[model samples]
Target: MSNDDELKQLRERVQYLEDRAAILDCVMNQARGHDRHDADLMGSVYFEDGVDEHGPVIKTGPEYGDWANAAHESVFEDHLHNITTHTCEINGDEAHAESYVMGAMRIKGGKIVSLMGGRYLDRLERRDGVWKIALRRCTVEWMMSGDSSVLASGAVKGFIKGKWDRTDPSYTRPLLLDGEPVSRW
Candidate 1:
């Protein structure tokens, strides 16, 4: 109808898209934090008083951050988390979401690898124009084991090595590279 009305509608739509993108980023950032053992970055995804029910353990957001980072460092030699899918429902400043997560890990000083499947049910809220999880309920589906000896011999060339910190190639990799690469970790 009116130009102003159309402009307002467009603005609202943009805001919604922006909110969704930010929320997705927040979710992905959690995995990256875990993979990198970055406790502070992981903690930023949740509210200060947020709750996390991780099946056997229930703790506050801060507590979860500490526990998770510690466990990964002590128990897992290497781990990677993948977010497969998620459904989000936005209601103004409040939102509800359920995201599927898969984790693969190699235990410390061992050749056995494990796979874990789960979902993260989150209650999010926007405060001070920033959206963060207020509560997260984790549901574990299954866990299976595998042998890592097949690939443990040596990593093939042209594959980027993963690190457990900001030093990871994903963080500092350049957009363009010419000639043969020369690096490994």
Candidate 2:
């Protein structure tokens, strides 16, 4: 290719990457707000068919919504989700993103509940000129004791730390269920 053509191609490639990164950031922010029990924020991020694989259960759009709302009502008076170390790749109209998420929930008793930390693997699609999550899988890395009662009562807690890159070794951990390692990734 000529020099000018090569430069144009490189610029286009950079622009594509930027667009994908922006979309991923939006998705992450939405998820963070949702984790903090903001249904309105979560609703903005998900498409009609969005699927959430949380822990050992698979939740469809409505199911996920119910779960989120219920959890917010029962455990938290307020919540905040922190997302970091995001890595994303775009392939035409489809893309995949992985991000580290940490969340803290303020419980009714004035105690904080935190889910250790985890990575979110997401499948995104460009639909009607907007990027939205089609599928998402959450992989918990570890948990810390924010509150014994909350932990005993099945509340999750924690904040994300470490690097955010798809090729980072941190994202390679296997999932677990009921103290047993899960086979599906």
Please give me the total number of clashing residue pairs in predicted model 1.
0
* TM-score of each candidate structure, all chains considered together: 0.89, 0.67
For 1-185, candidate 2 gives per-residue lDDT tens digits of: 89999999999999797768767766775665465444555666667888888888787754575677786668655565678788888887888989888866657675566555888898888888778788889998987646536443434444332222232233355632343322221
**Residue ranges of candidate 2 with Cα displaced over 4 Å:** 1-7, 147-185
Model 1: per-residue Cα lDDT over 1-185, one tens digit each:
99999999999999999999988888888888889888788888999898888888888876677799887788888899999998899999999989999999998775888999999999999999999989999988999998887555766545566777776656665634553343463
Which clashing pairs does model 2 show? 85-164, 114-156, 114-157, 114-158, 115-156, 115-157, 115-158
Q: Which has the greatest lDDT?
A: 1
| Colliding pairs, model 1 | none
Error of 1 at 105 (Å): 0.9
